[model samples]
Target: MLNRCIATDAGSFATQYWGRQPLLSPSGSLPRDFSDLLSGPMVDELIAERGVRAPFIRMASHGDLLARDCYLGPAGFGAEMPDQVDSAKVLAQFAAGATIVLQGLHRLWPPLIDFVREMVADIGHPAQANAYITPPTSRGFDPHYDVHDVFVLQVQGEKRWLVHEPVHQDPLTTQPWTDHRAAITERVREDAAIDRVLAPGDSLYLPRGWIHSAEALDNTSIHLTIGVAPLTVLDVVHAVVDTLATVGEFRTSLPMGIDPTDRGSMAAIATKVMAEVTDTVQHRATDISEGSATRLSQRHAQRTRPVAVRPLESLAAAEHAGFHPVEWRRGLVAHVDHHADRVVLRLPDRTITFPALCSPALDALHHGLVADATSLPGLDQDDAAVLIRRLLREAVVIPAKQPEHPTRTSRG
Candidate 1:
């Protein structure tokens, strides 16, 4: 997926461009255009027929985001749900030069959902998709930077993009472009680092904190922004700090009457505390590292979701689990831990336990083996069937017939 979005191979992107600089792949550089992921008609379907509501659908004109009421109203009659997109209102706004933004398309649209899931795995980061549709000769956003990295894929028509170097490089989620608005506004006044017109099949990659903005050309333009949020070293430090809660020394109360408001006294205390923490962390490095890795994995799992599962189909499959093959849920983050008498399957949301006898089956599934009851190890056929059935119902495994790759269809 990453290779498809860039003209260069994945290795070149990682070493030279990832989180460092911007790369613009000229039109026709990539293998194919992004119409397979999204298109102009798909945008209309979302607004007019998908029952899209606020947030999922929004509009921006010139440089400001319009109010929700401008394009959304009740669904009318049976639905009667306020905040659903009113197609008439959307058309009026679009005709008036407002850019329609389809947010979280990775969740709303099937193609994008599968595309983003694969892209996330390829990039080792959490990713999201949003479509920007702008009228001719208009800009939707002001010159600003995003805290997360983005890949802009031109789907239709053309748009001119101007990108300047970052005023603050590698900004965290808590650090937004607004915090450096003054610097960003000043930076854009100089010659841009990149000034190019992106047509269908073109792609651009921008690291976080790079100031950029785009304007539609003579025709309406549609594009997808795949935002990737990478985990930083600070995340690891935080997990290690959290582990301090298990140490009594770190949990003890601060010096009494510490004059909390006094800068001088607080500085002294901070110095002493820092030294103790640094020493403790170094001495117990191995344990802290192991714990921190688990914490980080849990954090990542919580942020991402497994591939979509079909409840009805899964239930039906569970009823006949002994015959067909099953594989671990694609993209599910799970860790299997064995104990004396039980095996624990830790998921992002919760943990599931099973008798120790089921350890072999769970281990095999966790390692990505597709199997039926007869193929499962360490368990009788009947017991393996029961285990498979339970896992199917729990959404831990899905039938092998389901494809994990994105289909060519734009709509699911």
Candidate 2:
């Protein structure tokens, strides 16, 4: 899908420009259908038919946000008035030259969710999406910088953008335009690092802290800004501090008499803290070890949107079909470990422990090498079918139409 949106290979875009420099892959260079991610009709459906609410959808003109009441009204139905958007009013506002911002469409829109989910898995980081629908010749924001990296894809019409080099390089998520507005405003007046009019299919990548501004051209403009949140050293520091809480000496109280306000006293306190941190820093990798890996994988698993599980239907199918063929669900991993007495399958939702005798069958499934329940070792065909049905009930696996690759199975 990235390649569908991008003009070049996904690997090249990632290796050459990601987090390092701005990339402008112009129109024709991109796939012809790149703009299909979102369009005017879909936006209409989301606003008019779906009954979208505030914060999720907002309107702005020259950087000032319009009052919610201007575009949203009382729901004629059961939902709160404040939570319902007045589609008519919003369209009127748009006609009057306001830029409509559709926030977090990756979560709200199905296609975007699938696309962003793939990117998150590919990049090993968090990614979010937002869309901007600006009237012809209108601007929505100030000449400011974002705290996260952005990939701006022009879906419709055109937007002329002026981008300046960062005033502060690689700013953290905590450091936003508000932190240094005066400096940022002064910098945008200076020459920009990149400036161009982005028509449909044009894509631009802006690293965090790159000052920029955009205005719709002769026609209504729609663009998607995919934000990639940077994981800073501060996150690792926080993780280490969490680790230091287990150390008794580090947890002990600071100097009793020193004033926290005094520079000399603060210096002494800082020095002691630094010494302890230095001692802890050497083992930071160990502190974050396999536990960190497990936590990350678990988060990815949890990030997967829930799917409908009709276990009763699956059970009925298995009974009629003889044996069920199971496949691993998308964005899921089953970390299987065996002990003397049990087999542990640590899943995204929960852990399952089965008797050690079932290890061969479980191991085969873990490696995606088993699909047919009848092929599992250590279990009679009937028992194997029963186990497979139970796993379907738990949503540990989905029914597969065909069998998987072969792997060594244990003799029972």
TM-score of each: 0.95, 0.85
* lDDT values, one for every candidate: 0.89, 0.77
The sequence of per-residue lDDT tens digits that candidate 1 reaches over residues 1-412 is 8977898889999999999999998766235679989998888888888999988998998789999999999987999989899999999999999999999999999999999998988998899999999999999999999999999999999999999999998999899988998998899999999999999999999999999999999999999999998899899889999887788998998867779889999999999999999898899998888888889998888878888889998898888888767888888988899999999998888899999999988988787677778778899989999999999999998887733331221110
lDDT of 2 at 45: 92
Q: Write the per-residue lDDT of candidate 2 for residues 1-412, one digit (tens) a residue.
A: 5655556687898898777788887876335544567999999999988878877888999899999888988888677666678998998999999999999888788888877777666666677899999999999999988888888989999999999988888888777888998898889888888889998888888888888999999999999998877666666556556656667777788768768789987998799789867866666657554555565556555545433345776666556433556655544556888899998888876898888888887766655654566677777777677667667766775666454543433111
* lDDT agreement of model 2 with the native: 0.77
Report the error of model 2 at residue 344, Å. Answer: 3.0
Roughly what TM-score does model 1 have, to 2 decimal places? 0.95
> How high a TM-score does candidate 2 get?
0.85
Clashes of 2: 0
Tell me the spans in candidate 1 whose CA falls farther than 4 Å from its real position: 29-31, 402-412
When summed lDDT is taken over every stretch of 10 residues in candidate 1, the lowest stretch is 403-412
Highest TM-score, which number?
1
